[model samples]
Target: MQKKSSIFTATHGVMTTEVGVISGELELRTTCNDAGILTLAITYVGAEEWYTLPGEDYRLHDPRDHEVVHRMLTNVLERT
Candidate 1:
C-alpha cells in the first residue's frame, strides 16, 4: 500500500499512507472510488496551510516524514 513515485506535477507523488506535521502552504485533492473515497493533501510547509482533514489512517515513506500522504483517507468529515 506504499509507493514511492513522483506521480504528481508539484508534489513528490501523493503518499497513500504518509504522515507529517504542517508548517506551510499545501494543495489537497480527494477522490472516491467504487467502494470508498481517497483524500490527497499537501502542505506548503511554508504558509502553514493544508487541507481540512482529521481522524483517519495514514502512511509515510520515510520514517522521518510525518505528513499524511499515501494513507487511507477515511472518516475525514467526522472531525467536524
Candidate 2:
C-alpha cells in the first residue's frame, strides 16, 4: 500500500454559510493499493487516533463514498 498525509487548518465555516467560525487542524491520510484503489482516513491534527464513518472503512471506490466522507468530516468538525 502507498500512503500519504497532510495537515491543514480547517474552519467549520467552509462547510456552511453561517458567519460563525470554528477552527481546528485537520489531518488527512490517503492510502492506495497496487490496483490504485484509494482509502482515506482522518483525524484532528496532532491526535493519535483516527476515525472512519460508522459501518464504513477508509476505502473509497466511488463518488458516493467521497460525498459521504465529506459529510462525515464536516459533521465531526462542526461539533469539535
Candidate 3:
C-alpha cells in the first residue's frame, strides 16, 4: 500500500528543487510506497504540477513511521 500526506506551508526561505529555489505559499506532499521508500514533493497551492523536494527520496527504516515523518516535515517547513 502507498500512503500520502499533504500540507500547506509558508516556507521561511527559498526551497531548492530540480528547477531551482522557490519561495512562497507552497503545498508539500509526502508519499510512502510499499517498499518503504518515501518521496516528497511540493507545488504552489492548488497547482496540478508537483516538483520533487530537495532530498528527492528516502528509504524509511519502518514504513509505519511515515505519518510521524510527514508531521515532522510539516513542522520544519512551516517555519516562517
- CA lDDT of each prediction against the hidden true structure: 0.35, 0.54, 0.76
Q: What count of clashes does model 2 give?
A: 0
Model 2 spans with C-alpha error above 4 angstroms: 13-23, 53-80
Model 1: lowest-lDDT 10 consecutive positions:
2-11
**lDDT per residue (tens digit) for residues 1-80 in model 1:** 22221112332233323454432224444433333334344544344544544546333334333224333232231122
Question: Which should have the higher TM-score, number 1 or number 3?
Answer: 3
Question: Candidate 1 regions off by >4 Å?
Answer: 1-19, 43-80
Q: Relative to the unseen true structure, what is the C-alpha lDDT of residue 73 in candidate 1, on a scale of 0 to 100?
A: 31
Q: Candidate 2's residue-wise lDDT over 1-80, tens digit each?
A: 66666666666423322323324776666566655466656666777767542333445565335445555554555553
Q: Name the TM-score of candidate 3.
A: 0.81
What residue pairs are clashing in model 2?
none
By summed lDDT, the worst window of 10 consecutive residues in model 2 runs over 13-22
Candidates 1 and 3 compared: the better one by lDDT is 3
Ranking of predictions according to lDDT? 3, 2, 1
